[model samples]
Target: RVRNAERCARFATRSSTRVKHEGAVSTVQVSVLLPECSSAPSHLDSVLNNFSSFYLIKKLPVYELLDRHFLETAVYHGAVFGLSYRTRIDEDNCVALMPNGHLTLSLDKDSFEILGFEGKPSRFKHRTATRFVVSVDLTDSSMAPGRRSYLRLLTSLKSRLQLQTDFLLSHHPGGGASIQPLLSRCDWSQHRPEVNCRVLTNLPCPAPLSCDPHSFLEWLGAVDAGISCENSSSSFLSSFVCPEPNTMHRHALSVSVSGLLLPHDIHRLLQELRRYVEQPRLASWVSMTVRGFADSPVSCSNHEHGFLRGGENFYTLMMFHDHTYQLHLAMGAHDVCPP
Candidate 1:
């Protein structure tokens, strides 16, 4: 829960910033310096519509997810993506429903022992096995309903530990209908990812094409945080300022979407963003920033993900009107660097 708390705190800080901006949006980490260009905005709004939506299932038994009827309809199809809600990998027995038909359990020592499933020590943070990772392939031939191994797992989850959590669930093309069987048995609420946009006038922006990544990111954060670079030397609250040799934009656009975001929708957004940059306009570039789930058991490219200092995992993409672009990816010390 520590990871979740820390994430919440960060989000709270973001909330304060939003109030300062009167509800305008601030993306996690990224900024593009618009160079003089010609382009018209078209269908840019459709990108927001394509983003995947997710649902929250309250107090759901972990075992219930193993229902044969549900598995056959969703999991076996390799379209489901799920993870326990409000769970922090650094301090909780988290569950993950992977798209590849695997149910991953990252459990503590006692819970791992009770589950009775074969698993290896977690390679996150600690070298020794303070925690463990058990991944069961629901798609394996031996995992068919009523099989010995399947029954063993069923009993472990249903009768032993009785693991239950608020699960964040989503499926590809089928979406909600794909997992209706499971949702029918539990209390649930559906939610669409929320989007916020802010336009900054007389904004100071750095030349991303030339600025060092570190400094660029810092400037991006300053803008997102609404920190005043106009502070006088004697000002006490903050003395932050835009990077040197920056140019002023009469207007700069910042757009962000937050929630149980999916990679497919993000890809489509990128496609739309590219279209946005290709049109004739006055901005030099456009960008999209993505923030990963704090409680996720996996990060970009499906690598094992863990939380250390709030699990700082995110990336920024800047598309230039010149047709050249740069992608900057980062996952702080706790995760395998993005692929």
Candidate 2:
């Protein structure tokens, strides 16, 4: 039976890829039957068992003809693999697996014809048969969007066809990990469900949820500012921290700022942030976003068009200072003083 199955498989292989794409648009219908009992494994199983049995019967001539017919049509359509038969048999029951995993027992061949036979066994008086239909399509990465849409169609069909199970596995033919990030930073919120954020056993951080980017940064900054005083360095920094680091740093600052002003302003704000941490004169930098500046008393005149004109404009200004420190390489120590 296995040898016959292999022969049948070889015969069917020719049309598998083509049928997978074109589907059973014009195909033969294959049918199989088993005992009529409620305890029957399933109709699909019966159909598969019947096909396997026929293949094992040394019915090479019929199998080869059917295989050739399917392959010829599939090749005409430029298919890569042809549909092959899959079946499993237990002591008293048998089951068949189909490419599409449909629950029916009628297979539609490429010629839009049905094939199979009916049989009854005494041990398993009750039996059922399941049917499967398939089609093939091209595999081109350039058609990724189209291929994705096709896969989605398959998913829908699996539900509508009432298949027992179906899943999609994608692969690159050349076999290398594609380094495109699985999920984009901006789209993380949207694709979060697809992300596997499970905690592994014996991990350094068992309560991993608490170690996200925001919390980690906050923890680091707090420790740097001496909020965590368990360490000796934290205690020293807390005691020696200067109150007017911002003012002293601002006096010594020189910046060559040129870019989209928005980005330049952002860069300046970042520099101000550095001064808050390193300068003896600045303790903190305040960041703010102001809108509707035309109504403010300190509004500057727009060169191309005055504020009173119809055109709309906006500006972002960032103010910051500089911090100068002396490095003592021998002692690995530094001195923070106003620039």
Candidate 3:
């Protein structure tokens, strides 16, 4: 869907809010395209370089996430993004701590029974129902320290199940300071977001708004991967070609950032991109794409995520020079509707 970004002041604010809501949740990678630029501005570079660092806690106990200090300092005060590393959602038990202070667990029937928590069968269950989902709001009154539900879950994870796994965690507003207490208790390492850039020369491109959605995404993916689309149907490898009514851009910039990205940082990057496009420039449009983690148990909010044929969930935002934008949110066949 496309919206005139500056048609009205109030509507612009609402659109900005929607962008933050839809594009920021559990992003695994972000890619940006500037069709006519050879280099990025220093300020933009700074923003991209300064994305918050995240921590990897090795073999951390699942019950530790409910620590009073960690919750009071990080989860309650600001958003904290966490996920179990190297754990497959469909096979092994997977855990996710969302920004809204909710802890979600996707478990098999055996593990779910062992955990002994109140939960519902997974919506993705087939005829037999082998999976279950347990979601708990950490900020709820019943989850407060010394409460009945809080103690029961803590004991269940600590004494009964004793679940432990490698965890990836990060917090906004406080960053390392907020999560240091949790890190101090376990073996951990901190790392920054990885950034990559490529300069394309004489690249074929289609009209941003006029091209078909699937075809445009195909062309964009080819460009991002440096694939040659000059094949014919009779060719053996790939019969991909740039869509018709396309132009050859003399220079274009492709930049990407990958990590356990937070929504706040992405929102800042969008503001910078908007500022960059608003200035007098040769290119009339630019595009940003965000991809969610493939194995995540939840996509936008609490929407269940599953892998049927390569569990893909993502969105692309195309901002034009005239303060208008197009948003395309997509999911795999087995996934639920995106927010």
Highest TM-score, which number?
3
Per-residue lDDT tens digits of candidate 1, residues 70-187? Answer: 8888889988888898888889989888878888898998999998888888767455678888888999989999999999999999999899998988778655677887888899
Q: What is the TM-score of each candidate against the true structure?
A: 0.84, 0.15, 0.92
Task: Return the candidate ranking by TM-score, descending.
Answer: 3, 1, 2
Which stretches in model 3 have alpha-carbon errors above 4 Å? Answer: 1-21
Clashes of each: 8, 51, 0
lDDT of 2 by residue, 1-339 (tens): 121111000011212121111121111121111111122234322322221100111111112211223323322233221111221111111111122211112231211122222221211112342322222222233213335543443344334332221111111122112211221211211100011111112111111122333332233233223353223335745542222211121111111221111222233333333334333432222111212112111111211111122212222121222222111110000111101
RMSD in Å for model 2 = 32.6
lDDT (tens digit, per residue) of candidate 3 on 241-272: 89888898999999999998988889889989
lDDT pick, better of 1 and 2: 1
> Which ten-residue region of model 2 has the weakest summed lDDT?
327-336
Predictions in order: lDDT: 0.70, 0.21, 0.83
Residue 217 in model 2: lDDT: 28
Q: Native-vs-model 1 lDDT?
A: 0.70
